[model samples]
Target: MAGSVQPRQLALALPHAESLSRDDFLEGPANAAALSLVDSWPDWPNRIMLLAGPEGSGKSHLAAVWAGEAGARSTTAHALTAAAVPGALATGALVVEDLNPSGFDERALFHLMNLAREDQAFVLITARVPPAAFQVELRDLRSRLRAVPVVTLLPPDDRLFRALIVKFCADRQLSVDETVVSYLVTRIERSFAAARQAVELLDGEALRLGRPVTRALAAELLRDA
Candidate 1:
């Protein structure tokens, strides 16, 4: 007994898995239009498209899907510069995400748009607010973006929320049955972001306690919320 060895408890590594495949994305009234617009690219009414949605509304995932199909380079607004425009345009397609006008570089964006037009390339712009709401000092840039077709993703419905919960759980390697799903769907905040957060908390708590995900566990986690 004195020489007996205790089992080694290796540190758990949470898997980083995010699949942006088109098939994996859930469809509903809130995001149907935005998805449709992404699928209709190159043939788009304009070279530039504005995708607006709340946080965790799947705009970035949708953008990733579109980038794959269009062979576009994906970047954020803050990373763009006048010198980066020509090289980015060489890709023939681009996706600039999380564009906040306040800290955005006006001259760089202005040149980017001009170069995009000259190259006949396509650009997808994503943000929490619509482009029209931005206070762009450059009149031409504002006009150009204002005319770009805008697609907004609204909040998820019951069906979509449930699907997201299941997806999030599965992504984190957590097995959740219908009971857990039913309980959380009714009590959790009505958003994809909330679904993701709940699953993360539950998964962490379950791992810490060596317990399975269940309705009771979910209740304990959501109780404080």
Candidate 2:
């Protein structure tokens, strides 16, 4: 009993809080137009607008920022129903997020759009692809969606990509220097999703091995990634 060896305990997978406040939103050429549209607010070109972009392009963050300013309600596309439209627009501002053709309720969305126009409530729809690409059975809904003004968020530029890696590391309370970030910029895919993934993997591995995050560590992990 006295010579018994103890098993090593793995670090717990704790959740980290991401800052989605307007100030925390990174600004760059990639998302300038999208940010401008969000900042313009009530002056939107139309009562209902669509924000489209590839995955991890900050559409949700921008929507949150706009929702905060507009005092809007947020709902997912799949969760929306015809009966829910009225309450969804009660705040006079609503964010219908992640609207894809796969599982969305067409009739419900159609009702919401018409109702929003009737009541002059502002609506922000965020999707990975443009509404025009949706394959809906409702012809009227398809036409209506195609007419909604769209603003697209592009992939981030080099500066913003580097900044994103650093910010993601900071969010996980992992202190990483420019060398690590610079090395990641070249090694990882040039996208927000990739930056977040790299940081998460690095954090998990560092905690597992009890090592500090460094360029060498990132090199090893990325080489295996």
Candidate 3:
């Protein structure tokens, strides 16, 4: 019998696509406003946009989309310093994420913003809080940050959280029961990361115990978390 298409060969042949594409995102009231900004960013009237959200709120996910859409380069604030910014800013469309944590390269960031505007390129930024939260010494940089329209992703609601689980299970080809689903929706933290953790827990436990997803099994798995 002919060997079917090799998995490795098939994988390489398919074009690589954006990781957190619009299709992979979940639509719900919790994140509607932020989603709107991300989906419409390529056409945004401004050259700069800010995305703010707590951990697990999908800020990075949307930022990745912007990088792909704009064909821009991305880096953490830590890797960028004012001295290093000219080259980084050379890419008109760029993404700087984890601004507060990634070394907060304010000088580079400050210059990059101006460069983007002058070059007619887009710069997308994501952080845990609004620009007001950052301590700024550069008057112009502070004001530029303040001027950019800010988009925030609110925490996910329970319904959206559940839908996330279902999406993951479908993606993983795992068969989950309604009771198991309901149990997790209540017990897991109301966040996308929680959904991911739950799936991993369940998958591991199911494999260990050789059991199908059930309320009791979910309870057992969650209890261990």
Q: Which has the greatest lDDT?
A: 2
lDDT at position 159, candidate 3: 80
Q: Provide TM-scores for the models.
A: 0.91, 0.96, 0.80
* Model 1 CA lDDT for position 127: 92
Alpha carbon deviation, residue 45, candidate 2 (Å): 0.3
lDDT per residue, candidate 2, 1-225, as tens digits?
899987775877899988899999999999999999999988999989989998878999999999999999999999999999999999999999999868788889999999999999999999989988778899999899999999999998999999899889888999988899899999888988999999999999999889999999999988966
Predictions in order: lDDT: 0.88, 0.92, 0.76
TM for candidate 3 is 0.80
Clash pairs detected, candidate 3:
78-102, 82-108
**What is every candidate's alpha-carbon RMSD to the true fold?**
3.0, 1.6, 7.6
Write the residue-wise lDDT of candidate 3 on 1-225 in tens digits. Answer: 598864431112222232477788878887888778877867886878888888767788788876777788888866777776667767667788887733576677877887777788888888888887677888888888888888888887878888888877766667987887898888878777788778866766776666777788888767866
What's the CA error at residue 79 for candidate 1, in Å? 0.7
Model 1, residue 202: displacement in angstroms?
0.7
